[model samples]
Target: MLWGCFSSAGTGKLVRIEGKMDGAKYREIIEENLMQSAKDLRLGRRFIFQQDNDPKHTARATKEWFGLKNVNVLKWPSQSPDLNPIENLWQDLKIAVHRRSPSNLTELHLFCQEEWTNLSISRCAKLVETYPKRLAAFNGKPGDLIVINRLAYHHWAIYIGENEVVHLDPEGGDSSSSLELLSFRGEVKRQKLTDLVANDSYQVKNLLDQRYRARDHYVIVKEASSMVGRQLSYNDDTYNSQHFARDLRYGEAESRQVRRAACPAWAGLAAARAATNDFSDRRLLYRSLKRLSK
Candidate 1:
């Protein structure tokens, strides 16, 4: 889950986000962000949200939570992320988040807040410029593409059947898979039906389904249409629409070039970029693209 705030000398600030892990709605926080952004606008001035179509963000509940305001949520492409700019910034933020080594939520919050304030504007702009690369990554393999993390709860895994592998998952115990890796975490390795079972290094077979608690744990990257697409639409009414549109263009381009395209993060970058575009702020745009291509 991620939250983004856009600020400018003219409009003050606006807040937006992708959502939370459990998918819980945070109206108070959302409103707080809006109110923060609203600080800059004149009492009657209008600002946009550039919201995505995540259903969670656009549901009647969200509208009710936001209530009536001078704010307008923009319409954006349904599943495009390759072009959204903020996605790129969020990636850096996540990397920074992962690197922070916070002991608890309070520490994490403080670190995150500082990071947010210190974020460079040049990096934000490059996120928009790197659309070509994003489109390239998604040009193929567009369906049911699992992120396939290697480190389960930051550890290794086990083996079970032919073509099946297992893991000690974060949710709790062990899990195995014949079609794909266990739900826990592991790098994607193409092993033959015989070889997967034969690997000597791994502990072969957990047998108990109940033992594998983390087997059900999955970090959803895309939705039925595409996580990227939904994020593109999210906050289109704010400032991420252009980023989403840019992602849509990349997705379309990749589809044309290869026939498939996946990689939801690219769309997140598109959203970030759109936010920057919204206020005509070039803060992080330049640097973001450089980091993305690398």
Candidate 2:
């Protein structure tokens, strides 16, 4: 597992946990990194630390350490992940590191650290600026579409209420370590919104509401819940997470990402230009297009 933190200023130190992290190890990490990170970010002594209520994080020793250091800790709410903007950074970091496809533990560590450092301060500011929007809370009702920004792509989920969602998850699962590569096979899962999103920025988006009449909320919830244990075929070039969510909401499965990949932007531009009669010399244009394609 990785432990990282970021303020509105920018990212802090990102460290890999070598083994099972107990209270002592957790305290040690905070002792060694937290103050230095705060100093590096220039948060000053008044910045309040925010952390989940994990047992290790809130352990007696850990609390005492914070007290001794005169650290102020934010009283984070349970199951309310949307309040934390750092989760968005974590999501971006994971995507950036995974794209590198680290060969081993060494490369994984290097990539994680490098990517953390490479996170732009501007992006952090944007996340903080939009903090209020995320704070509107998971105001999504049952059967609403929840879209999580995954940097390069969007992950969709069908909200079933009570802070739970049903979504397509990769069969390979999330890589807790750099060794695991993401795969295309998918499984439908019903899990807490916080757990599924896990520090990622998300918004409740029922984009097709105006385009297509929505099915009854009860029916949508029932159908989505029934899919909890089902295994779904997943191919990036065909079906994917967006397709699954759209199917649940619209009764039709379509993947824009797949369509885009099939006909790339350049290919579409070339086709459109080729169809136009405005070109001075069609043969010259064709020759240039052929060379570009090559």
Candidate 3:
């Protein structure tokens, strides 16, 4: 296999590896290639390394080496290839090499080196420029669904495009009340997406329609809009934001009977078990939630 690093300016160093890479060898490559690249680009301490969650890349020894070097690495999403711009560069290089149709492994290596050198800084910069938009696109879309964890509770909302989401808020008071609650402070209301997500961790809960058949987008928005001024009673065991979301998406009330059986402190886990009916996998859920909290 081959390993390499690149930045917005161009390719850094390319290393050819004949076999598996262990933590020590991986650390050596990073120290040699990345450190030199940092110096060449004059990035110094400001350069942040990016790597996928490969076993060698994330091994304890490799992490310790990065710590000793005081190099900052970008926290990358696991199993997300599209988030890595270098993947695109790899694809381009592969295409270029294949077009030459080298007759032997030696020729192939030479072609790879030539193609890597030919990659322009302007092309790399364009890829880097798309990073922010790519992140935004990954985060959400219009009419997209989101689930936010607010400590012991979870809330649901529907994105309405342009950095805004509408959700059913119990604190907004009943539709008949004339008092206006503070922004995101009460009731079913529309709030800036940032405000809703502020100080909270969220997950994109949509796009799992095959696993949990979601309602039509128009229906979801209509249901959300209709509930805007209505004050829904909040009952942790029976009805709440989560249940509201379930009702809108699945047309069924979320049963919290199992959660009710447990103490409020353990309700989250109990509810998850009730929903999945897989006690053995509860630890996985806990682990995922713990990781997201960090």
Winning model by TM-score = 2
lDDT of 2 at 208: 68
Q: Estimate each model's TM-score.
A: 0.38, 0.59, 0.48
Q: Report the CA-based lDDT of candidate 3 relative to the real structure.
A: 0.65
Residues 90-203 of candidate 1 have per-residue lDDT tens digits of 556666877889998777777776676566755544543453454454321222111122211112222222223232122222223323221222122322222322211222
Q: Which candidate, 2 or 3, would have the higher lDDT against the true structure?
A: 2
Q: What does each candidate score in C-alpha RMSD?
A: 19.8, 10.1, 19.9
Q: How much is 191 displaced in model 3, in angstroms?
A: 38
Which portions of model 1 show Cα errors greater than 4 Å?
7-24, 38-44, 64-67, 79-83, 125-186, 189-294
Q: Which window of ten consecutive residues has the lowest lDDT sum in model 3?
A: 177-186
> Which candidate achieves the best lDDT against the true structure?
2
What lDDT score is found at residue 268 in candidate 1?
57
**Per-residue lDDT for 1-294 in model 2, tens only?**
898887778888998998888999899889989999999999999988878788998888889999999999988666444346776677788899999999999999999999999999998888878776766765787888998865344678898876689988754333233322222346789987766776567888887677677788898899999988777655432456766787778776333533455555445353455555433212324344566686
For model 2, what is the error of residue 19's alpha carbon versus the real structure, in angstroms, after optimal superposition?
1.6
Q: The CA-based lDDT of model 1 is what? A: 0.38
Error of 2 at 17 (Å): 1.0
- Candidates 1 and 2: which is better by lDDT? 2
- Model 2 spans > 4 angstroms off: 140-156, 160-164, 168-187, 190-226, 229-294
Compose the digit string of candidate 3's lDDT tens values, residues 216-236: 777766776776765665443
TM-score for candidate 2: 0.59
